[model samples]
Target: MSDHVEEQEMEAEALEAIFDVSFSVVHDAQPFVWSVRLVPVDCGGDESEELEHNHVAVKLVATIPPTYPEDCGPELDVEIERGLAEQHREEILGVARDEADANEGMPAIFAVCEAVRGWLADNNEKGLEDVSMHAQMMRKKKDEERSKAKQEQKFESQKKAEEMTEAELEEIAVRKRRADGTPCTEENFLAWKEQFDKEMEEEAAREVAEREREGGSNKKKGAATEIKSRRDAEREGRPTGYELFSGKAGTMNLEALEAAAEEAEEGSDEDDAVTVEDLDVDENLFDDDDDLDDLDFDDDDCDEEEPEI
Candidate 1:
């Protein structure tokens, strides 16, 4: 208990000493709260008459922690006296935190106060500099948000694209129409017409490409089939009779085969030799003299048959 008391008393003394250094100190003895007014910032006591009656200065306050500058870093807070943007409030808090960090293991209230005072002093002799700084910061934040939104939207669109099949996408593109129920104006008509024309042109181009691809594929398949057919015929190593006579085997030695065929036609396959006379016809083979001899022989046979029996 004594040690805790001693530590509190020492921290109180340090806070008092910091308050003595050209600052306005608000004392609340029960809780040991110190509202150290950092000077030279527009935290509100200057007399510039062009200001609105509702304006007041920004304020910084620190709650004296028993373990400050020893066991823990300073936790600074800002008090906005009137309407203030989140940007400036955050900036002031950041500056105080930075000062606190720089003066570690030492009482940093005065240092933090001074750092804020210097920033306010450099930025403005009058109180209105926070307005421009606040606007710029807010604009920067908005621009970042917008850029992030666009990137997210593009990512989502890409995902949707990847999910759709090529045929599905093409079908959707062709069939999509304006869904708004408002009566179409001339401007809407023209825009729709332009869009329709573009879609048609793209579709035509795609069709042409598809046709070319199909044509190339068919041509290659036909060539492959023709080559395979020729391969099958070669593997068989046999020629049809038509192929033989059609001069398809002109590259082979067929003179002896031709001679064998001629002999077979002449009924003289015992040898390949043949003569025109061997194939000639005898004109007297069916003559009348042979028919008269055949009739006389028949009459002699008829007379001899009766006596011999």
Candidate 2:
């Protein structure tokens, strides 16, 4: 046959001669198969001493492929005779696979068998305990990784929500469904509407109280000497005393004048005197952007009526 098949036969014969009773031909067809049983050495005892009471044996089955020892490695399987756990058998098989790969494109069965024998000798004393501990540690590590991945996913979802715009957040909040995906009913809507109206009334009362407090503070600070504040002037739809003199009414104010004088006194003449960066305007004043803030409207000015629930 091929040179690879001839080399395989020679290796099998050598193994049989070497192992004697421990080695046997499993199949002798075109693709040869054989098995060898390995006994662990008593490392602590002399060569002539008998094996320890806890001695264990493993069986290695080698299936020679058509191109073994030339282009690829043989298919190897390992089995423990007794005493040792299955994980130990797997660990020894891994050693055999590594040895086979290291000796590719040459006679490798002897090298793999010797490697396995060395592993058994090295781990003979504590093989079962070590394997059990290793399995437990691996299970714990896998569980921790699973939990960490879930926590990372949750953090990413929260971060995404935080990055959403205010309008997007409000849209999500306005969804008609509950957290569990149930649709809102009329009773639920009515209850929510009542609570929402109550909250709005309370908020309006708080705003009115805040404005009255500010007005009282302004009154205590003499009205003429200091000039009317922007909020009072906006509410009255007229200019302050400073605005009446500067010809910049509705546009400039005391703050802008002070900023401009500071800039000019420090030797600059920029024409844009009132910039957003130079002022701390109240954002609430722009909330209702109707151009007719100067005009007064009664409740009867609106024609649309609220829809009947």
Candidate 3:
């Protein structure tokens, strides 16, 4: 019975040792676990056809935890496993080293640590740094957008304020201008305003006109251009009307005038060429002369009596 109790204590010790190594490896590998075993092994070889056997053998098996996701529940577990593999490789190695040192010559513990290390190597986690960086960048972009919107809103408010101020100023000016007895109706105001506007427009027009007149008056006059009289023009050897009409009157050839006069004389001679034999003569012509001679005979006798008186 004591031998059985000793055996049971040995088993318990073995189990405790195994559990410690596995738990250490798992904790350091943070989310991975190791499976350990102890097996009998023969260490002594037969000589001369006799076989010598060793007492026991040990083996270790390990399975790395599945990678974790960045979400709740099982996914988080997987993510934890992966994160442990990548971020805590050194820690896992340290745990294996410590367990190996503590359980020197214990093949089961060594094998367990080796298996856990191998599992950790096989199951590496994706780095969370990249996700963190992306989140930071998004945050920065959102902040920038918010800042720009705020600035735009501020500028719009300022612009509206300025417009309101301008409107108030315009209203004040209108009110002040309307405070007088001037009627603001379409008919009465338009008539009175039309007269005032017409006067103002006329004054402006007169000012413009006066400016133009002053500008004209201030301009220097050019010298008076002398125009020659007809006589003066003639005295200056310029062309007269007859000279202009007759084509160089003094230079006309006498032969041309003689030819023209000869033409005229020829025309006259044509008229004078009528013969008296071709004409009818008046028959009373000798009687009219005889009557005039007979009346003239008493003139000398009346003149001699007047001379004696």
Task: Give each model's clash number.
Answer: 3, 0, 11
lDDT of 1 at 199: 100
When 1 and 3 are scored with lDDT, the better candidate is 1
Which runs of model 1 end up more than 4 angstroms from their true locations? Answer: 1-31, 41-56, 82-84, 125-309
For all candidates in order, the CA lDDT equals 0.63, 0.74, 0.45
> Which run of 10 residues does model 2 get worst, by summed lDDT?
300-309
Please give the range of 10 consecutive residues that has the lowest summed lDDT in model 3. 69-78
Off by over 4 Å in 2: 42-54, 126-309
Top candidate, metric lDDT:
2
Give the per-residue Cα lDDT of candidate 3 at 228. Answer: 38
lDDT of 3 by residue, 171-285 (tens): 8888998886565678987788889988999999999999998877665332122333544666887667766434354433333433444445456565554433333333344
Best by TM-score: 2
**TM-scores across all candidates?**
0.33, 0.39, 0.15
Better of 1 and 2 by TM-score: 2
RMSD in Å for all candidates: 24.5, 30.2, 34.7
